[model samples]
Target chain A: MSEPFRFHTRLNLVELLGRRAGTVRELLTGIREVPGASIYHHTHRFLQQHHFLSPEPPNDFAYWISGSLGLNDIGERLASIDTVRYRRINDLRTRYVEILEEALAARRNSWPVCQESDEFHFMSCRTFIIPLPAVARDAGEFLDILGRISVNSLYYHVFESRLWLERGENDFAVWFEARGDHELAGALARLDPYTITLEGLRQEIIGLVRRHVQDR
Target chain B: MSRIDDYVPVAGASEVEELRLLAARLEGKTIRNVNSTAVGGGVAEILTRMLPLLKELGVDARWDVIKGNERFFAVTKNMHNALHGMDVPVTGDDLDFFVDVNRRNAAEMDLASDILFIHDPQPIALVERKGDLGGKWIWRCHIDFTDPRPEIWAFLKGYIERYDGAVFSAPAFSRPLSVRQVLISPSIDPLSDKNRDLGEDEIDRVCAGYGIDRGRPIVTQISRFDYLKDPVGVIKAYRMVKEHMDCQLVLAGGGATDDPEGLRVLDEVKREAEGDPDVLVLFLPPASDIEINALQRASSVVLQKSLKEGFGLTVAEALWKAKPVIASAVGGIPLQIAHKYSGILTRTVEGAAFWIKQLLQEPEYARKLGVNGREHIRANYLITRHIRDYLLLFLSLYFEKDVIRL
Candidate 1:
C-alpha cells in the first residue's frame, strides 16, 4: 500500500505554529481584549485559519461551538457578547467545560457514526468517528473543523470511507478543503502508498488514532 | 381526476375521475402518516409525492417525523437491521431508548388523524396512543417482515394489535397480525421528474456529462448506499458479464436524510470495485432524478441485485422506460418482474451474471422482455395505479364491502 496523501507540504509542527502564531495571537487577544466580541468569533477565526471554517458565513459555528462549549454557555456568551450584557467570565468558563464534557459524551457513545445510505453509491454499511489520538493531539483543530462541516457531510464522508475505502479517494481532498485543512490532505498523500489497499489505510488510521488517544 | 390525467398517461381520465370521486367520499377526514424522517429513504420519497396528491384529493393528509438523537437513531437503525434478519444484538437499553423516543413523539404529536397510517417499525409504538382517538389506525410495514427478530417482532406485535389494520407491500412480508392485513405493493411515478421520458438529446447530454459510453450496452442500478441493495454484488456480476460481453456498469445513487449507514456502505462498494476501469460508481444527490432517468433509459439492460428490498423503485422505473431489468427475487421486486416474461429474477451473483450475459447475447429476447416489463409496470406499478389503489383503500375502510365495482 502506498503512503496516505499528506495535506501539508511541511510536517514541522513548530514551523506551522510559527506561521500561524499571528493568527493565534490575534484570536487569543480578541477574546481577552475585545469587550463586545466573544470567544466564538476568536474560535471561529482560528478554525477558519486551520481550514475548519468555510469562507462562507453561518458555517455551522453554532453546532460546533455548542458541541464544544456546552449549550448554556454558548447561549449566554452569544447573548452577552451581542447584547453587551456584562457577564462574569467564570460563568463562560464553566459553560465551556460543560460543553466539552457533553461533546466528549457524544463522542464516547457516538462511536462508528454512520452516514445516510441514500447519499452515495456504495455497498457496505459504514461509519466513522474521530480517533481519540487525533482528537487529543488536535482537539481545537478537530473542533474547529467539526464546527465548519455540516453534521450530514461529516457523517457522509466517514460512512463513505467505511463502505468502500476507495471512496476515500473521492472525498480526501474535498473533506480537507472544506475544513480549510489542506495540510492534512497533504499528510495523507505522503503517508498513503500508491498501491495500498483500502483496508490497510483504514487499519493505519485506526492504529494512529488508538496510539494518539493512548498517548494522551 | 384531471390531475391524474395530467400527470399519469397510463390511467384513463375516467378511471382517474373515479379515484377522485372515491377520494371525495373521504373528504374532511384526517389522515396522518408517521415515519422516521421526512427525506432520504423510499418511504419518505413516496410520502413526499403521495401526500400532496392526497391533499389534492381533498383528504386532510399530514406527515409526522419521529424525534431521536444519534443514540436513538443508532438503536432504531439496528432494530431495522435486526428486523431484516440480521443478528444484531438489541440490548435492553436499545429497546428502552426506542420506546422512550416513540413515547416522546406520541406525546408530542397530535395523534388524531381519522386514518392514522404508521410506516415501518420506527414509529410503530405510536399506535400505543390509539386509546379513544375515535379513529381507525393503520400500520404500514414497508420492509420485509417475513423474518424478523423474534423479540423485536413480539414487542412490536403489541403495538400492531392496537391498529385497525396493517398494510404490507408483499404477501411474504405479511405475518399473523391480530388486525386485518392489506397487501399493497409500492409504485413508481412515471410522470415524476425521475421517471419521465426524456428527449434523445437530453439523454445524450446526460450520458455525455456522466462520461458513460453510448456505443456499448449499459447496465445500471440506482439505489441508496445500503448493503441490502447489494452494490458490490452488482459489480461482481458486471465483471462476470464483462468477461464475455462489451458493456459498462453504472452504479449511480445518493444518500437519504435519515439513514446513518449510507457512507460506510458506499466506501465498502468502492473498495470492492478497485482498479475496475469499466465500472462507474457515482455518488449522486437525491435531486439527480433526471440523471437517474437518463441512465435507465440509456441502458440496454438494468439490474437491481438487492439482498433485500422494500420495493426496488429503480426496477419499476427501468421497466417503465421499456428496459429489460434483472432483479433479485426479493421483497417487492417479484411484484414487478414476472420471471422470464417481464424481467429476469436471480438469487445469487452467479444467477445475476448468467442473466446479464444471456441478455447481452440475445437482443431479441431482451427486447421482448423489456416490452413485457413496460406493459406490466403500466398495468400495475404506475403512479396512476398507486393513486387509484390508495383512494380505493381509503374508501374500502369506510364501505367494508369487497365488491365495489369501478
Candidate 2:
C-alpha cells in the first residue's frame, strides 16, 4: 500500500541579512544578490503572518514601494504579480527583477529614494518543519485532519511546499494523484491560495475532498 | 494570571491548539529564561505571564533573576543607554564590574538547562558558561541596537558571538553577527488587566479619581518615567494641542527597579508640567494594571512619543484596546503601525500634536483607525504568537539545518 500522508506544520525563524536599500538601483542590486530565502521572505511574510484577516495581502516590496517610496505605478505592477502561477522561488525572483528593471527603464533620469530610516531591510527565514500526530490514509481521513490542523500547517502544504521548495503541485494534490485520484488532484492544483484567507482555503479544500469521497 | 485556554477566545481555538503542537516538539527540554530583574520592565512582565502557560503546556520552563548590586545596575544602565545610541560614558571599571556580576550569578544559578534563554544586556555575559554548561544559548536583545556605542557593543560582541542564536525585536535593532539572528517582536497579553476590556462606569471612575474630567477629550501616554520616553516632549505636544482645544493629558507609569534615572526624569516632567491642572503627571505603582487599562480605554487619543524605544509594547497595548494611537516612527513602532491606516505615525512633538488635533476633530475617522488597529494586533502581535515563535526558536537549536521534519 502507499504510505499515509503525514501532515506537517512549520514555524519560521526570521533573520535580518544586514542589507538595506533606499534607492531603486540599490533595491534591484539587493534583490539580485540576496539569497533566495530572503526573496521568499519579503514575498510570503504577509501571507503567513496575516493568515486570519487578509484575503489578498501585498508583498513587502509592493507595500514599501508604494507606501514608503510613493511609487504607485510600479507598486501596483508588483502587487499584481500572480504568485500562485510560479512553482519555483528563482522563477518568482526573475519576475520581480524584470518588474524592477522595467520601472527603471521607463524613468531613466528621475530615481526615487525613500527617507533614510525607511529603507527596505533584507530578511530571510529558516523554517523548522514539525510533523503532526494527524495522518490521512484516505480522502475521508484527509478531510477530517485538514479541518483540525493549524492554518500554519495548511499554509506550509499549500504555499511553501508548492512554490519555495519547487514542488510542481501542493502535497495534498500530489498525495491524491498518487492514489489514482486525478480529478481531485487537478481541482486542488488549480485553487488559487493567494486569493483567499488560510481558513477559507482550508474550508474550500475540505469541500473538494468531501465531494470527491462522495463521488467515489 | 490567565491560563492558555483563556486565550482561546481572543486568539481563537486554532491558534491556541497550534501552540500545544509546537510545544510538543520542545517536550522534555528544560528552557530556563534569565533576566536581570524579576519585577518591573517588559521582559519580567512577559515572563511572569508566559512561564505559567508554558508549564501548563508541559514544557519545563523556568525563570531566574540575576543578582546585581547598585554599582552593577548603574553600570548596566549606562550600557543600556549607550546601546540605545546615547552619548553615555562607559568606564573600564564599569565593564569589569558588569562581567563580575554576571560571573557571580552564573556560579550560583543552574546553567545546565537544555535551553538557556538570556534576556537583554544585563544577563548577556552569562553566555560565557555555554562551553562548560553545554546547552544551546539564545541571547534575546530587547533594545534599540541600531546605533549602539562601539565600546559597549565590542564588549558584548565577544559573549554574543558565543551563543547559538540571537533574538532581536526589530530588524532595525539587529546587527551583523556571527551568531544566527532571529526577529521576534514583543507582544501584549490581551487578557491581562492592563489590556482587558473595562466597563464604561469603571473607566469613568478611574479617570475621575485621577482628577481627570470625563467630559473633555483625554490624551494619554502610559510609559515608565525615562528620558528616552521623552515625557517632557509629550508635555510640550500636549500644550500645543491645548492651545487649539480644551482637553486633558494623563501621563502615567511607574519606575522599574533596574532604572535609577526614573525619579530624576519624573522631576523634569513635573517641572515641565508647571502645575497645569489639565496636565496630570501621576506616578503609578507596579500594581496599577486596572487603572492603566481604564485610562487607556477612556482616552480619546493615545501617544507613545519615544525618542528611542524597544518595540514599544504600549503601542500594541493601546492598539489592542482599539484606541487611535499616534506613536513615533522609531524602532518597532513602525512595525505595529501602518502610518495613518491602522494608526498615525509621528516624527516630532508638533507632528504628534497635529495628529492629536486632527483625530479629535474627526471622531468617525479616529474610530475607524482604532478598529483597524485592533485587527492588526489580533493578526500579528499577541502573546500566543510570541510563545509560538519562542518554541520554534528553541526547537530550531536542535535542528541545525534549514528544514527538518520532526
Candidate 3:
C-alpha cells in the first residue's frame, strides 16, 4: 500500500465512481477481486495526465493501449485493429473484447487453462464495478466484464453510503495534503461522481485500468 | 423564605407548600455550590436556576465559580473525560496544575457555608479545606461513572473519601464509597428560557432564521459541540433517513467555556454535513435557551444521540417539550426514555435512523410518546421535584449515622 495514497484518494475515488464501495476494506477487497482499485486509479491518472482520455478527435484507443500499460501482447492484438473504423463507444468495446479473446488464446498456450467457468463480466451494485483481474491476458476484458456481472456481494454487505456523512467536503482532502498526500488531494479535487450513470462509470473505470496496465 | 409564593403556580399550592415545609427543616443553613464555570453546561445551568429556588425555600443558597486559566481548564476537561471512563490521561503535572488552581481558589473563595456543595472534579480539591473549615462537603459528581478507569477513579476517590457524602445523577454512577452516596438526577426548569413553551410563530421564526424548511419533518438534537454527543453520528443517521425520505436534520449545539473540544467537534460535524443541503449544523452561543426551546418545539422528533452521557439534559428537555425523542441507551438516558413507551431508545446509527423514520412515519404514535414523555418528566424530573429532593438530601447531611428516607 502506498502511504502517499491517503483517505482523500478513497474519497476522490468514491466521487469519481458516484458511490462508496462500503468500508475501506470492502472497497479494497472489491478492487482486489477485480483488477485492483490502485492499479485502475493510477492507470486512470496516468492516462488523463497523458491526454489519452475519451472524446478527443482522432484519439487512437489502440495506440493508447499498445505497450502503454505492461500488456505488450494484448497491445499487439489491440493495435492490429483499424483504429479509424471505430465510431461509437460500443464499437470500441466490441472490437476491444475480440482482441482479448485472441490474447486469451495465446495465454492458454503458455499457461494452464482456467476452469470451465471463465465467463466473467462487469458487475456494479454500488459505485465500483470489479476491474478485469490481473490474471486476464487482456485489459479489454474490462469492457466485457463491465457489460455484465452480478451485484458485488462483499461490497453490497459492506455498502457504506453514509461513511463520509460525518465530514465536510475537502476535509479528507485537506487532511491528506497535511499528511503529504498532495497527489491524492489533487486526484480527489477532480472527481464529481454524484449523478454519474453506470455507463459513464464503466468508461471512466476502463480508462483507469487500461492506463494502469500501460503504466505497469 | 425569599418570597415562597413564586413557585405556587408551577408546583401548585400544596406541592409548593410541602417543598417549603421540607426546606423549613434546613432553615438558617447556608448552602453554597462551587463549580467549574458560572455559565454554560447542565451543572451551571441547574445551579443557576436551583440556588435561587433553594433560597426561596428558606435554605440560604449561594453559587460560586472556581477560577482557572486556560491550562487549568484543559487539564480539568481531561479529568472530566477520565471520570466518565475515557482513557484520557491526567499526568502528575496536570494533577499538580489542577491542585494549584484549587489551592488558590480554596484560599481566596469563601468555603465558610454550612453545606459546601462541590460540583464535579474541578473543585473536588476544595474539600482539602475540610480540616480548616470543618463544613459538611458534598461532592456532586455529574458524570457517567459506570466504568471509570481504575487509576482515575482511585485519584478522585482519595479526595472523595474525605467528604461528608457524594451525589451522583444515577444509581449506576454511585460506586461503593465510604462516604454516604445519594442519587440526585439533574432537572429542567420548565419556565427557563431554554425549556419554556413558545408560540408557533416563535418556533417558525427560529426555523426560518436558520434557513430550514419547516414543512419538512425536522429531526433535531440539542447538545454542546462535544464528541461525546456524537453529532457526526447524528448526521450519518440523518443521511440514512434522507436516502428514504426528504426530511431535514438540525444538529444544534453550543460549547461550554470550560470545554476545549467543542470547536473541533463542531468543525467535524460541519465537514460531515458539507454537501447535504437539508442537514443544518448550528453552533449556538450561550443562553440560546429560547432558541433551543423553539427548535425543540418545532422539530418533528428530537434526539439525544450521545455515545456517552451523564444523565443527558437534552433528552429530558425534549421529553419536557412532549417531543418523541430518540436517544442512545447509554448512561442515564434509559432512566428518562422508556424504550417504545415514553420514547424510542436506539443503540446505533441504523437504529437511530430507524426510530427517526418510524416517528416521522407514524405521527399518532409519536404524539402519544410525546404526551407520555412530558408527564413522565413532570412527575419525575422537573425543577420543583428536584428542589424537594435536594432539600431532603440536605436534611440527610445533618444526621451523622441515621439513614434518612424521603
Q: Give the number of the best model, judged by DockQ.
A: 2
DockQ comparisons of all candidates to the true complex: 0.01, 0.54, 0.01
- Residue by residue across B125-206, what tens digits does model 3's lDDT show? 9988999898788888887777778887898899999998787776456555677666567888777787777888998899
Docking class of 2: medium
lDDT of 2 by residue, A1-216 (tens): 568999988778788877888987798899999889898999998777656545445898898898778888889999999998897889999999999998888845677788767788889988877777789998888888998887778998998899878889999999988998999999999999887888899999999999998987
As for DockQ, the candidate ahead, 1 or 2, is: 2
Instruction: Encode model 1's per-residue lDDT on B33-150: one tens digit a residue.
Output: 8899988777998888888787877778899888889998888888888888889989988898889889998888888778888898888887777785667888888887757889
Place model 1 in a CAPRI quality band. Answer: incorrect
Query: How many pairs of residues in model 1 come into backbone collision?
Result: 59
In candidate 2, stretches whose alpha carbon ends up further than 4 angstroms from where it belongs are A1-6, A54-57, A105-113, A135-148, A172-187, A203-216, B211-217, B225-227, B230-249, B255-281, B349-354, B357-365
Give lDDT tens digits, candidate 3, residues A5-44. 1111011111012122222223223334432232223222
Candidate 3 residue runs with Cα over 4 Å from true position: A1-216, B1-6, B65-74, B86-89, B93-97, B100-110, B256-264, B400-406
The structural similarity of chain B in model 3 to the true chain B, as TM-score, is 0.88
TM-score for the first chain in candidate 1 comes to 0.19
